[model samples]
Target: MILSTASSSQANAAFWRFLATRLLVSLLTLLAVSFMIYGLIELMPGDYAERELFRKYSGTGVTITQAEIDRVRADLGLDRPFLVRYGEWLWNVVTRLDFGPAFRVETSVNALIGDKFFYTFVLVVGAMLISYIVAIPVGIWVASRKSGIGDGVVTLLSYLGLALPNFAIALVLLMLNAFVFDLDVTGLVSQEFRDAPWSMAKFLDFLGHAYIPLLVLGWSTTAFQLQTMRGLMKDEMGKLYVTAAQARGFSGWPMLIKYPARHAVMPIVSTIGFDFSRSFNELPIVASILVLGELGQELLLAFLDADQNTAAGILVCITSVIIAANFLSDLLVAALDPRVRMRGGR
Candidate 1:
């Protein structure tokens, strides 16, 4: 009894330590990424002041003078040294949660991003859920039917999904919608609910339009995961433990689920963060094509306008989501597999 209690206590302590270490690493990574994003934006050719001034005077035959540019820079505090500005920005972000202002729109970065990131998060996460839901069963089924026609067909479809670009799929769907369905396929909401208050109708309208982007984003992810799960399941099935389980008369679903499936799923659970990051990497172009009012679109516009504050804010938020997802994945993996916790403890 005493030994059992001691082992349990050790496990609890190890879990807490693992959590703390992951938190520390995530924070440090987020800080470094934020600094790099800010520095890259700073290195861009023109500042917001320059872009605004040039846009204002261009095609009017009025040349923008150095004096005018300098005046605008001074007013916007853009003349400060890079390190000094970055330090202040970092401090403000850390202490006050102030992401500063959107240079072009003259609005707080926080205010400008209101609800936009939420929409993006909902779309990305929804796609991820769909991918996992579809991939797992199909992957298991294909792996079970290895070398059969069903496996060949699924393998072909998975390859096609991975090879075809997401934008191409979106374009094909758009063409089909235009020519055949005549349904509204763009944006997160229909015209009636675009500005409507949050109600069941508006939310249903959102889901109605959301499925296109979800399908587009989830297509490749589902294929990749299906291939991964199938490979992992096949590998696990050939292992000694699976053979031993079969000898014990554990067959079919029970045998697969009890012996191989549990082990095969560990890698998948551990890779949730990477999957989220991959989905986000494809979001900007997809969002633009679909005319979705999400932070991905805002991020592109901010960079084009040289609005560093807005761009940095959006990038940092996206990075935070990825980091948070990674942290959660680590926790889940550690919980499901005691080996992971033991390694962390060591």
Candidate 2:
């Protein structure tokens, strides 16, 4: 027993080392994305100050002196060579936790993150909760039925979800809420209410607006999970070992609990981290339809109308969020799967 425990502890330690290595790679990828953002910003047809000049110095006497533009560039650190600027930005970002500041928005980049992150978290987490709650039972039902009528129904449902876009789903739900349910979801809180605070009223109001996101995201994945699990179960059930278990009078529950489900769970858990991360990307479409004051809508605005600085800050925040999600996913998968430890793959 001691020998087995020591071996398991050694294996776990090695697994964490592999995970650390994988995280280094992911961090490098994020750094590359940041560099790309910097390059593109530098490559913009005009200086970063050009847009601000137009907005601030609008109509008459807009003939800005070249020296002034150069001064602005120097202030923004844009006068530096692209590589130099990128290195400084990367170093400052990673070490000092300074992503600089947004040129357009008055708020600090980190402040902006704090403002919108909770909403994004609330939306995505709600959706994920609903997906699992619905998907798990549906997957089991389809697997138990195995190529029968229930499975056919689950397959069709999955296809329908896979076919529909989030925007389409959100829009349909919005129209229904407005026209049919008359829910007044536009106000995330009540019309009389204004802020999100810890209160029963706020909690209930949040829940009211949460359903559309929950339903759209949850329903989108149910089908895919159902199909994946069903196929996995089918494959496992067909194994010679499983046949022997059945012949030895092992019951259905034992076969499912001990055999197929355990084997099938690795793939599903592997995807959960990805799915959770993907929810952030999908936030904009839902935000657009519902007119929610969330990060998705904010990000779209940052890219579309806000200046380069604002967009860059948003991009930085987004990149950080994505990297964190991916890292968490890797850790979750490592923890969930023993084979992952043996293979030295995060």
Candidate 3:
């Protein structure tokens, strides 16, 4: 045993030690990510204030002089030193949970992202669940059947799914809905429920419109997971331990799952980390095609409009989620695999 005792005391201590290390590392990573995002936005040419001024006055009635633009820039804190601005932003976030006000929209970054975060969460989470549900059995079936027609069909579909971009999938679904189904598949909510207050009707309406995006996002993820699971299962089944078990009359699903499948599934668990990040990163293109006004779409617009505060906050939020997902996956792997636990996450 890695611990001094074979008792609960040793197990509990090891778990706590692992958790504490994960938390500390997560915090440090978050800080580094925030700094990088802020610094990169600062490096972008021109200030938001200048952009706003040009937008307000360019080709419009008023003429913005250089002096006036400079004054506006100062007012918007663009005149502040890079280090000073970054320090203030970081301090505000740590102390007050403030992400500052977004230019053009004139709302706090929190409010802008808060309004849309749930929908993004819903889309991503729903897709992830669907992917796992479809992938697991399909992967196992393909692995077990190996060289059979069912395996061939799954391989073909997986390859196709991986080849197609998400937006292409969304576009195809939209075309299908238009020509055949007549289902409401365009946006995140129906027109009536869009501006309406929260109600059961609105909630149901949201689900009704969510199906297509969910399918598009889930399909690619399912394909990737299926490929991964199939490969891992095949490799584990070929190992000496599995061959030894088979020689002892262990066979069929029980033996497969009891021994090899457990090890095979580790990669899938670790993949949960990248899967979340992939879903978030893929959202912008998919959301744009579907006209879903979630955090992904909003963040894309923020970048286009040079809305630095909103953009920064959204980036930070997404990065934090990715980091948290990875941390959770680490914990799950340690818990599931005794080898990993013994190694203390290496």
Which candidate should be chosen as best, given lDDT against the real structure?
1
- Please give the range of 10 consecutive residues that has the lowest summed lDDT in model 3: 2-11
Could you give the C-alpha RMSD of every candidate to the true structure, in order shown?
Answer: 2.2, 3.3, 2.6
Report the C-alpha lDDT of model 1 over 82-129, residue by residue, as the tens digit: 888788888989999999988888889998897788789998999999
Q: TM-score for all predictions?
A: 0.92, 0.83, 0.90
326 Cα displacement, candidate 3 (Å): 0.4
Pairs in clash, predicted candidate 1: none
lDDT of 3 by residue, 169-277 (tens): 8999898998897775878888877777888988988988888889999999999999999999888878999999999999999997888888888889888979998
Backbone clashes counted, model 1: 0
**Segments of candidate 3 deviating more than 4 angstroms:** 1-15, 246-251
Cα deviation of 49, candidate 1, in Å: 1.0
Clashes of each: 0, 0, 0
Error of 1 at 146 (Å): 5.3
Give per-residue CA lDDT, model 2, range 158-179, as digits (tens). 8888899888988888888889
**Model 1 error, position 195 (Å):** 3.4
Model 1: runs farther than 4 Å from truth?
A: 1-8, 146-149
Error of 2 at 317 (Å): 3.7
Q: How does model 1 fare in lDDT? A: 0.87
Output the lDDT of residue 206, model 1.
89
